[model samples]
Target: MPYFRPIALALCAFALAVPVAAQEVNVYSYREPALIQPLMDGFTEQTGIAVNVAFLNKGMIERLRAEGRRSPADLVFTTDISRLHSVVSAGLTQPVTEAKLTDNIPAAYRDPGNHWFGLTVRARVIYASKARVKKGGVTSYEDLADPKWQGRICTRSGTHSYMLALTAAYLHHHGEANTLNWLKAVKANLARKPQGNDRAQVKAIWAGECDISLGNTYYMGQMLADPEQQDWASSVSIEFPVFEGAGTHVNVSGMAMTKFAPNRAEALALMAYLAAPAAQEVYASDNYEYPIAPGTQADPLVQSWGSFEADPVNLSTIAELRSEALLLTELADFDG
Candidate 1:
């Protein structure tokens, strides 16, 4: 998607967003509790639209299915475009016709038919021990397959959405064969069976269990920002190993409107506001996420770590590659 014009906090029409009546809207979200509350609070303040939320660990599709057209949900807030597209694929979400949303979000970041839209982005990158790994040693993602690093690499399970997303990116950039081969090679190099979340990977590094691991860019930024996590987070530096300088692989945290949303107007309104510069800035500053909106800058922590090229593949493609990635994972026999 190309850049968006600077979001003007001006008179914009949200015919679809105005309240159908005076009741609050309900939302079901898959994003972490801490990440979504800020936006929810903001929307409530601006519109007096009380929001009832169901924060879930999983099973949103099932919940929506059970709730059916009777579901009180007005919006579905989640991280990752793949997850958002999955909702679209399930026929649980409908396309939004809000002019503000159409004008704010980009085509690549949002559905071509407007089923879902990206809120923020994250880069899939390597973070290495400051004491053990050299600044320039681990430069590109492809290098994870190197034999010299055997029994030294740390990662999450292959089945995880994070690694699978990376796998899909590989398939897009290289071919399917190349991506599978890369997965197998990297799988063989595991220090321990891939088994932890991103933060756990950092702990593993600190405990001397591993030298390097995959992580999202924002996690490192968050760790460094907090004093408690600073020691470990600062000890491992974020790296961009550019393959032929093509840039690093990136991902998104996105959202979509529910198909039978009771508050479709409010849902659409909140979405438009989320893509605006103000909301974009909040995401960048508070969560270390990259704002998908054009001209919106990343947080200082991310900036201080330095910048690298990000994969431009729209997230829907990432969803398409997920099944293929899972197949590669099974063939590789990765335990985690």
Candidate 2:
């Protein structure tokens, strides 16, 4: 069994001493508590419903399954469409048709079945060397495979969720054959064998080992905030590359209600609160992710990066294609 480090919100501690049933909601989150502490704190402050979180580094689904109806979790928070979809597909989540959720999150960012709702969005963008690459040099996703970029690209493993999501989107747009060819071409263009996290690729760019890398947009904000990595971040510029006819590829950090939520009403309230404008603002300003709620703007720093239309394909569709994307990545020996 995987162990989860429990995190009790400071404001909720008073509930522990109360004799009567406590007004609280339990969360099983793959996301670090610090990243979401502000939103959770706000929810508790507004509703007086205590928030208790179990931070799980891995095995969220397995833990839920093992606990079954006895699971103390009311909600599950995670990033990536694949993970959110996996929970719903595993029968661990229930449909949430709250108008507050449906109205705030764009349809493309939510589950068609109402099983999950995205709180924030981040693009899979190109991090290009400011000195080495010309503006407008990298125009689209297809451009990455051009012979001109051979030995000039750096990226994490193709099997990583972020990469797979992009590949799955490619599959949606161009079908398997073209996606496989693109994968092979991009692999052939690697400066080194696929390695490291998205930020590591940026560090490689700063080292002059590569000219550009594929990475999520939030990583730029994360890098800039770190004193040591600021130089790596400064060496690169974020570019929103589009698909041939559509828009830039994106993924999300989202939430879902557990099937057997003990505090169903409170959980629903938290879910609605998370989707509302106030919580959306916290996601944007604090975590550096783009808020999903309509009319919410990203942090000023995030806004300075410029914007592009997010790919219109429903994220659930991309999630459904993740297996094929992974298979294609393996067949192409993308990490080799």
| lDDT for each candidate structure | 0.80, 0.93
Show where candidate 1 strays beyond 4 Å: 1-21, 225-228, 243-245
Candidate 1 versus the native: TM-score?
A: 0.88
For residues 235-282, could you state the per-residue lDDT of candidate 1 as single tens digits?
A: 788887654446678777777888898877777777778889788778
For 1-336, candidate 2 gives per-residue lDDT tens digits of 123323445336657666798899999999988988888898899889999999998999999999999999999999788999999999999998889999999999899999999999999999999999987778799999999999999999999999999999999999999999999999989999999999999999999999999999999999999999999999999999999999999999999999999999999999999999878878767878899887888899999999899999999999999999999999999998
Highest TM-score against the true fold, candidate: 2
In model 2, which residue pairs have backbone atoms overlapping below 3 Å? none
Model 1 clash pairs are 17-265, 139-241, 140-241, 157-336
